[model samples]
Each structure stands twice: as C-alpha cells, then as structure tokens.
Target: MNNEAIDIILAEDEPALGMIVKESLETRGFKVRLCNDGAKAYKAFEESQPHALVLDVMMPELDGFSLAKKIRLENEQIPIIFLTAKSQTEDVLEGFDVGGNDYLKKPFSMEELIVRIKNLLNRQEVQKTAAIYAIGDYSFNFPKQRLTYKDDEEVKLTHRESHLLYHLLQKKNKVLDRSFVLKKLWGNDDFFSGRSMDVFVTRLRKKLAKDDRIEIINVRGYGYKLMVP
Candidate 1:
C-alpha cells in the first residue's frame, strides 16, 4: 500500500487562509483537516491523530502553545508545525521550547511548508529502523520487540508497536518525526494510521510508566523523545 498520503491537522484562525492551505495540501496528495481554533484543533488531534499538526500561534480558547503542551502530555511523538504572524526570536524560541518542530511565518509559501514537513517526516522514518536504542530506564530490543527494565518482568510488544517504540527510542532525547513513522510502519501517514499510531504510543507509554526516571517528552510539531534520565 502507498504510504504517501500523510495526514495533517491544520489549525488556523483565518478562514480563507485555512481553506487555502488545506486545499493546497490536499492537491499535493496530502490529507489535511483544517481547524479554526486551538480548542477544536486539540479535539481533532485527539480524534484524528493526524501525522503532523499545523498550529496557529494565536487563537481564542486555547492558543497554539497551550494546545501543543496538552498534546505533548497525551502523545509525545506527533509532529507540529507552527503558523504565526509573530517573527520575534523570543516567540520562536518559546515555540521551540513548547515542542514545536517547525515554524512558518504568515504569508509563507505552500511549497516551503510542504518542504519542511517532508524533511521532518523523512528524518522520523530513518530513526524507526534503528537496531539499537535506549528508552527510559530500559533497553529497547528492536528486533525482538521488547523493552527490558531493571526488573524481572519485561514487556513484549507487537510488531507495529515495537517498530514505533524503536523509532522513538532511537531518537533518544530528540523529537521523532510523525509522518516518517506512519509511512514506514503502516505504509501510509494518513488519518487512520495516525490514529493507530496514537493508540500504539498510548500502550507503550503505559508500559514505560512504571519508571519515574524516564520521560517520553512530546515535541508538539516534530515527534516524541524518549528521555532517559
């Protein structure tokens, strides 16, 4: 199956602009869901689990940063792209700090956004096939699909879940790209696979939750990081 159809959740307050971006991406063979507010974007994210998120910096109810933070808490490995009129360095830095993977200023070209998204997604795919990875307080067995902690019980993982975990584990403290994972594992980075990946991530998180020393940090626009402390 073709995995080229990467899904994206676009949160833009401007109606005309949102439509343009969504239509442009769809024309480029991407599946995009356009949202008007930060709150709705978050809801769509929870339900759709799009490969990547295009978030507007300012909005009513939640704003991009807050939504990103919330999304991070839920899933650490979803790619997020920020769209904003603010070009200040501090704002950009703050966005990065909040886990944004990429930022596009207002009046940005669709081509440019697409390029950045593709680049980020490509990086995510490379990490998935990594054979060796350290996750949290455990060593991730990629081929075996298991994470062995310092305890007697080792959790065995399913094929897709293991592949996803391996991808995140390889990233270590860095963000793993969302589209990269969906394309590599499910052969598509579309809406459905994105949702599936979320479920898998949830399972992985539950298994790893036993260790308080490790954290799976979610970078809003890029992906998740398996932080081993």
Candidate 2:
C-alpha cells in the first residue's frame, strides 16, 4: 500500500493532540483529515471516503462508537481505529462490536498507529485480490458486486448483499455462526441487525434460486450454510 495515496480521517476533540497526530501521519506520507468532532469526522468521511479512520472515543455530537456504527452501516470494509483513554475490557470489546478494526489506548506511540493502519490496508488489498468465488453453477464477482448464474442470468448485489454472500461462500458446506455474521456485517448482533441479516439471506436465496444445487440453509440455532453440491 502506498502511504501517499492513503487518506485517513482523524477525529479527536482535543485540538493539540489532533494536530500532533495529523502532522505525524502527514509526515509519514499519509493524507490526513483532522476533524475536531465525531460529526465533522463523519461528514469528512462521507465527502472524502478516506482509506482509513482514527477516531477518539470521547467526542461531542457523536461518540466514536456511534460514529463507527453509522459508518459500518454504509461501509463494512473501511478500516477504523478507535483511540480512547478508557482501556477497560468492555470498552475494547465495545469498540470492536461497533466495527472498529483496532483500539489504541491514550498515550500511544504514533509509530504503532501507523503500523496498524498499514496492516489493515494490506489485509484489505488482499481481500480485493481474492474477490471472486464460484458457487455451484453461479459465479460471484465481489469487486463488481455481480452474481452470474450459468453464465447467462446476472444479479446485481448491494454492498451488504455482496459481503453477506462472500461470508456464506467462505463457509460453504459448513454452518456460519449467526452472531458472527451479524457482528461482521451489521456491526452488532442486535434485534434489528438480526432481522436485516435474515432479509439479506432471503434476498441471496432468491438470487441464487436459479440453481437448485445452491442452497442457503438455516442451521436452526446456529446460522446458515451455503450448500453447493
């Protein structure tokens, strides 16, 4: 990954710390957008579609967890790092639960942050490289968000649908944990997210219904299995 081409949104309420972090990242060849509040950071995210995000947990208007949840609704792949003074186990778990890729405690080294960002971007690049999958008689091109059946019928998938299908394909023939999929795709395993996942599963089933060999089966208490025979 080229640091110069990477854009990062850094959301911190403290002006001094924000500038220090922004300047440090910029010095390392990253393009940094420094926003003082979570709301402004979100606006910057919507506008720039940055490569990654570094957010402070305590911010006005929208907290880091809330902002991350909102962003996950829009994009599941974008790397998000949360910075906070609170280092409790629950806080860290909450960060991940809200779709944060990494959690950094306050008084952290800039070098560590840079390394984490690069690592995430590299992983994302690898996923992009392996974007296509074959399921029974259907072909899924994740990057293009297109699913083709028998080389003729084509189904365009939304971002969520594409990700959901990708997860299912990864665990084909085996049960994919419902809670795991919900957390990965919807940022949380809440009631509404569960309902959303169910709806997407149905949509995917309908799209792949052309081929009877491909079936997304509910594992009852577990999750779903994409059985491709």
The number of the candidate with the highest lDDT is 2
Count clashing residue pairs per candidate. 9, 0
TM for candidate 1 is 0.58
Question: Which stretches of model 1 miss by more than 4 angstroms?
Answer: 1-4, 131-229
How good is model 2 by TM-score? 0.60
Least accurate stretch of 10 residues (summed lDDT) in model 1? 123-132
lDDT score of model 1? Answer: 0.75
Clashing pairs in 1: 3-187, 3-188, 76-218, 76-224, 77-223, 77-224, 79-221, 80-221, 80-222
| Candidate 2 lDDT tens digits, 148-180 | 988888887755677788888888899999999
Q: Local error of candidate 1 at 92, Å?
A: 0.8
| Cα deviation of 102, candidate 2, in Å | 0.6
Name the top TM-score candidate. Answer: 2
Superposition-based RMSD of candidate 1 using all C-alpha atoms, in angstroms: 11.4
